[model samples]
Target chain A: MSHVSSSPKVRGGRKAAVGNVGRPPVAWALPGILFFALFAIVPLAIAVYLSFCHWDGLNSPTSAGTANWTRLFKDPEFRQAAWLSLLLTTISWVFQTPVALLLGVWAAGRQRSRAVLSAIFFVPLLLSTTAIAMLFHALLDPNFGVIKEIGPWFGIDPNIMGSSTGALLTVAFVGGWQFMPFHTLIYQGGTRQIPQVLYQAAEIDGAGMFRQFFHITLPQLRNTITTSSVLMIVGSLTYFDTVLIMTKGGPGTDTTILPYLMYRTGFQTYDLGYAAAIATALVVVATAISLILVRFSGFGNMRSTREGM
Target chain B: MSIDTRPVTRPARPLNRTRPAGAARRRRWGNPLAGLGSLVWLVLVIVPLYTLVSSSLMHQDEALNGDPLAFPTNPTLENYRTVLDSGFFTMLSNTAIVAVATTAIVLVLSIPVAYVAVRTRSRLSGLAFRTFLLGVAIPAQAVIVPLYLLISKMGLYDSLPAIILPTAAFAMPVAVLILSGTMRDVSEEMYEAMALDGASPLRMLWQLAIPMSKAGISTVAIYTALQAWNGFLFPLILTQSEENRVLTLGLFNFMSQFGVNIPAILAAIVLSVVPIFAVYLVARKALVNGLMGVGGK
Candidate 1:
């Protein structure tokens, strides 16, 4: 009020008054800052610290130097989990992205059918991961699960969850199933953003549906594809709840991913230091990949512009 | 790019041209193929959900030993009764509290932060927004050990806040990203007019920003609620008691204890999903749009 009243006397006062009018953006941002600092930043810093120390929950830490890091690199379980995580990430890219693109294209063309299909497909995503895992677990039960009895006729192992490779692949497929709708929506939004004129022009040039799709639609969806891939990669690497519920990294660590490995090493083994090292590595890898995606793929710039829409 | 380079031998096509007789015949074939494709997808989508619902209604023995695909001739509430009787309601209540609290806090905290990030030119808000973006890439699994230690040290262990706070924290980056994006869509003239009418910044936000960004708010609210509701890691690590168990952990125990009781397990799964499904139905559009924002980010 004082700044406003004095603003008429000087130009600088008006600037200061505007800056201090009722409140600046910073005032509104304070709670979020504090919250993020405590929960996000502080815990992250502590995890980094814990990674360097050999501390159990029961006792104070002693410095382990890089022993935890050395062990993390050498631990076959960790290696297996890391490989599985990578596999899941790659499989999602190879499989889910295209499937999502196809679904998105299909959805964009037909509104009513899209609505019904979307409602059906997105159910897995909306339901808890634990619930989805449990649902699949039951559906694949060895004796009476519908899939179990039916799979053998099609040359699929009825008890796929009992084997290591089968378990990993099944979980990956489930992860794709759960998240494809999300990617579909992203691609659908991208498809919508294409100007109708481009398609009309293509039609006049004697381009059929396939040609139009291959040339214009595919090219226009590039950014959306990049964004969804980055998300799927990060999401797959961090996949936990479903895997934990369904297999508990069972059939001898086949389905274990980095996150589940970290959880098991930390909670079950009570080796917080080792687990923290894995955690630190997971963070580093995830952050590095995300940075690469944001930088090389132009995700960061593309997102803000797309989101602003 | 290819449109302009077509062969000269080909005649210029009529715009909005009608299909030739042969093309029309092909179209007749294509429609059935398209229908079949859609039907295949629909079946793929519905099969699992149908299994969940159907298995829940079946007799336990039949679900486990007989044909699991068959509809129950005698659909019973016995499985639901078994689940509910075994403290399902308590877990539901606990989940409700956590989800609602997390959503409320996220919406309240994110709105102003987003508003400021969108509306202001302040370096502080800009820095704050950048910091929030960093949170998006930080996986919760990477920090769970530290979170577990922190919660215990702060004496919040085995409590709902222990779970709620971290879940909400994990949710903030996306929430703020979404809300700020939404808030930026409001016209600047509206803000200026409100200010010219003797409105304070807060007043301007309330009158001009909030209403305009209601869709974004709903999206954030649903997303945060969904996260908190489906959260497993936080509650798994932070809380120890059955008293503190959210629906995820509760259903988990149901699975472990009643592993062979297919009906009971399905019943619990169905119970756990109902609330979230209800929310999804109500906010289906916002949820899709919200996820689109997430992917866009």
Candidate 2:
């Protein structure tokens, strides 16, 4: 019943169908296979290879052995960027998850309010990251930005991005704001996959909303939570557009994260090898986290339903 | 919490029934906690946007001198005119071409792999599936260097093709994963019947898969379009000229160029957002459902 595949055993029938259909000569898949190989697989290999060499996008690459790799660990900027990214990931989980879940549950259950609230929330998600960045950037500016003025009214610094702590938190907050709707949708859709019977059963048992949420909703959303967590972490690890637009890893590198760091290094500094090394580290870290979650989290175990959609 | 006094009235039907009256009554009674939560959510999302839009319309002096939160008293389209007159249209066109081309290419390329992966079920198709799944984990930032180099080596450097080709490449992972998942939703018997009709895979793909997976296809198209439209790094690193700029890069350049012209910049940002927002409105459901496919499966 999972919307993903309907049944896992569909594969058995697929295999039988393949036998009768002659499996459409493998050549039929050439164009797609070639595209992936050249673009995805090959580029990954090239990145790995280039990570071990020094190149500046001009001359031939010279073998640098572990020079670039070693330098990444030694470089304080690299370390800071990596740390900030990790912090962003942590903040996303702490802030976005519960908030999105709350709004999502509320939206999913209600009728009239759901449409109104969803449209409001989903506006950010619809706007391009650049637009979101510009919107926040304008609002966060000290001189003319509106949020700065509001900050004084509320006794909080409107120019939060000016301070190191505020910059990091603000960046994380903006990132969360733009994406919370996305996570909210996942949760809303996930809430749908939860059968009404469960809530009805809880109601029949004289369970309160809190009790039902604790005993039913939380457990049922396990896979979804795992999936969004992985997404959030990986998203944080590789987040570039907002940071690039907002801070440019600025205010003394307070907001620098791995992807932006890699970008600045490669594009601005033309340290292709060093950037590739950072890129390799980012991919390794992201892939490792994702693999670990998938392995340990029972990520595919939401029974009788589709996964993400 | 106060106990509900309403009598519970379960539906005669078993599963998938609406909430009983008592439960609905309890929900309708409204939880203050939920109300507070909703109010907070609304403020968080709507306020910043209002600020952006309002400021975009304000005069520069007014924006700088007036209360930032106030709506524009002397609203003007001067900022928008400034933006449009400054080659914003060219950048927009470039962005449109990139987005459209990328989405078209991704759809053209992903459909076959999706069909093959689902119907062939061969080792190679499985490999194709795994390869695509692997690409999902490989962030574009990781391979961007090679992509840059490859695009340059192909003599596509500093051009729309440089951005378009790579954007399409990166989009394939999510696009393929989504399409294949939706394709798998096609019942085995459907494929069997197509095979019994002696349909070539291409015919089945064109006639059946495309029609049946229309929702998934639109989702892929929208996502790919979104990626291309919102693309920054590619356009930033690959294309360098004013003529080659897309909206994301264009907006960046426009902001810095008109630095401190907050209204003009905000107006430009608002203008840059209109097309994508329109697209999102049109395809909102597919976008949501498609995203769910990613998270759900």
Candidate 3:
């Protein structure tokens, strides 16, 4: 393992001889920076700017002058959407984390069946969100879907998509089904990184498998959990495709999370300015969560987790 | 320093001797609860996938009438034929173009950025890296309204470039993060050695950095390609024409177009995944590592 801490000293000693000879100039990053700025940063600014204006998306946007912002605070629909987004994020995290964590730890074993099962488990991640949504949509179709045939045995209603709670849960479940494998992979990677010595020592102390997992695996996976949770939270916040394809935020806005609400206001309603407000709000929440993640993970410093090892 | 790469050549002799036989036995039989949980999840995963494939092969009447869990006694490829005939190839081609173009653009733009960030000590490079670090938080959906405006104003709406440009832009932060993480692993001594031979920065980037960071590059390529292939919101909001419809949008349209034709819709879903499934089969390790890279180390 290379010691990143000693690199500055090495560079200082070689400063007179090499003198940044092989170092790429800062200009090398300009194209990327400019391109990213034009698309990402500029649009972010535009979203915020548009939030304060009223435009139907045809003529120049006229100043709404906090009209959208004030209405946003008063709008029950926005409140519901924000609530639904939070609910979905919470449900998805709860549903996915334990299942993924356990599966990840189990898959980290060297058993042959575990490897094959892991591959099978990864199948969902390969399919597009649209494809997965459509698949579930068909399977859940009240009249013609498979759910009509098998739902009773499990006490699930065939009309799950048409009911409010069911629709939200369906959205959450589908999102979980699609993303659980990715999170599982994260945990699997984290589990493997736990030193074998720790487990061995725990076993020598007569700790059971569950005890070892709780004491050793869970604590070791703290950084991994934070990383996955931030991604999951941000991902659920912006989930659009599945809702668009499956429910269209239907059952009377039951599943209209923030992104879907933003889509409807911006595109379907043609209230682009109001939609931009919703979008801006989402950006703030997502950025705040990410900043917290970066601060907690020390990711902003580009520090490797393996540094002290 | 390839994000997922670890030493695989550790000598096994001493470790094997020290390893407890009970440890190996315990690993196999240790967690019946976890095994049971995995079994339940297996069924959860398999049922829908089974429905996907089995229902696709059944006739529409059979799919609606027959038991969903039952194997089709009269399986057929007619549903596949229906999907193939309904512009599936067009959407497939369009998606392929988007994926390839997005991957290419992301690579061209991000490689230099990552290279400079890793090799240079300038404050500007650090600022550039920090910009991307924050950029990772900006959800693509948050910018769709403005992107639509920008794409329309640029006269690129309803075109592949509209989808390509923004998709690549959104993919930049993760691409740069993964690439720089890998690039930073190129030992300083290697660069010093190249400098002693009078290698320029550009030459070193092309000859040394690029070759050594192949894992990261492939990961970025696969990541961006998957992003473009699976992207729905960009094409949905930015593009308006059938010719511009990518696979995800195509599948979304198929949901309504093949309404009540459950077999055909399932067939479309199956066909859409075949390309990626092929990639997964061929390069599972690289793809898994690439995906793991998304969560960082």
Candidate 4:
């Protein structure tokens, strides 16, 4: 009786309590921890060290102390990328949040009618970054692209993703476009989770669609709404693929955001030290943004809830 | 892009007062506006695809100046044949090996780790959990130079393994994050019964964790494949020879060699996109369901 109960109970409890207080490692947890440590942790530490020294990403190495960091602090390109990242992040967050909310609310009440359209729009998100870039690339081509093809009609002969103002705006728009499915999905999930009975009660109170969103839907989806914003914020800072494939920070470096600059510094210039410093700054920015959003949304409390798991 | 600007409220028609008056109006009102809005977006996404495929079929003359919206005047498979015959097979195989190998490693490495992150209870496990999050934040571009150096020094540059390892490393965090969420949903009662039946911990994980998280695992697997196959940076920076080119770099190579054979390029893209798109079509619901959770929290 004693042997039978204790071993099973303790094992079960440990399984239920992964990463929790005062418990043993579960059966499979050990190997998981090892792979992550070897692949994730070691490489990260090595990267941080490599950032401080002049290695050329080849040869032996020489220490640079704070020289790399200091150079990054004063570099014009670095400043531009940082500034651009901030601008894009602000624009995406401010714009996408409201539009996403509106789309989410609009889609909720009309399911069957929106089904085919949902699939069409959803295609972009499921696709390769290669494809999305290609679609816009063809459309935005300076000579005879679709947008250019149609631009004269609107009397707008602008380089939508080629000019500086257009570059960030286009990036923001692309970012917004690919990500709207995610927002719609989360809102769909969260709103569905809100019991139908509640909506019936709200209708009896003469609540309209707009009021329903603010009073019922928004409050209910507070968790997801905040999560979507935080994810977008982080994503905008780390936006790389679109910039790489389309702009390459081109049209005379007009679209150089932080990740693009890091790519340029590290790969193009072989400045390992400076690249690392830039990478560190990016990490700092990403972490700070996450923490800020977490603090604002109270997701940090998830640590406490996670403890219960 | 038309928006359905339907009236949010009606003149307080008494509930159940007029069956035909309200019911008839409601159906007519929402359907067309909703249908019209979606059509605009549908055309937005579909037109390029239509052009891309149609352009490949048309001769160069018809391609550059023909009606952009019309079906190909003389649809042809020559472009498809061009890509398939012109060392395209090698590039296709190269892409397959890199993408398939990366997917295998990520699945093998992350599944056990995800299970641990869900089932273990240790400070070290907690450290590992947070460590995976680093894979997400560190823009891989930051480490490309060192990675290139590292791969090149190890005599792996231009080798398929060079791209495979780094891609898997970058993707592992998200994979684990997704898998752990799926694994956590597997109840402890199920695991307890297995332990009671004298199953080893290894067996328990195989039977319980892996089996339960199948949907989540597959979704993550498909996504990882898509990411690796479409990876442009690694193969671009690491590979040097035409022999080493994956599909993505192959496109760039074709661009350099014979100019952007837009028809051939589009045909190749069509080929590349269809397999993954087919995979998505089959698994669309599972993917969306998985992402709602994965992205939500």
Candidate 4 stretches with Cα past 4 Å from truth are A1-27, A98-110, A298-309, B1-40, B193-199, B258-260
User: Which candidate, 2 or 4, would have the higher lDDT against the true structure?
Assistant: 2
Ranking of models by lDDT: 3, 2, 1, 4
What TM-score against the true fold does each predicted structure earn?
Answer: 0.88, 0.91, 0.93, 0.83
Which model is ahead, 1 or 2, in terms of TM-score? 2
Clashing pairs in 1: none
Report how far residue B180 has shifted in candidate 3, in Å: 1.4
TM-score of model 3 vs. true structure:
0.93
For candidate 3, write residues A37-138 as lDDT tens digits.
999999999999999999998999999999999999999999999999989989998999999988988877656677788889999999999999999998
True contacts preserved, each candidate? 0.55, 0.55, 0.66, 0.27
* TM-score winner between candidates 1 and 4: 1
> A1-309, model 2: which lDDT tens digit per residue?
235334433544444434657245667667877887787678888998999999988899999999998898899988888888888889878998998887766766546555666767777877778888888888888877776567887887876888988888888898899889888877876766676766677878888777877777777888778878877877777769888888989888888999999998898889999999999899898888877886777653223333332
Chain A TM-score for each of the predictions: 0.87, 0.89, 0.91, 0.85
Off by over 4 Å in 3: A1-19, A204-207, A302-307, B1-30
- Per-residue accuracy of model 4 over A1-309 as CA lDDT, tens digit each: 233333322333544433233223454555645654554455556667877899776568698888888888898989988999999899988977876665554454434456445556666675556556655665566553456566566776646765788777887877777677767666655554554544556766766645655676677677767667776787778668788777888778888898888888777888777877787788778877776776777643222122222
Error of 2 at B223 (Å): 1.6
TM-score of chain B of 2: 0.88
lDDT of 1 by residue, B26-133 (tens): 233324544466567677778888888988998887787777767887889899999989898889999999999999989888888988887677788888887786
User: Using TM-score as the measure, which candidate wins?
Assistant: 3
**Candidate 1 local Cα displacement, residue A155, angstroms:** 1.2
Candidate number that wins on lDDT, 1 or 2: 2
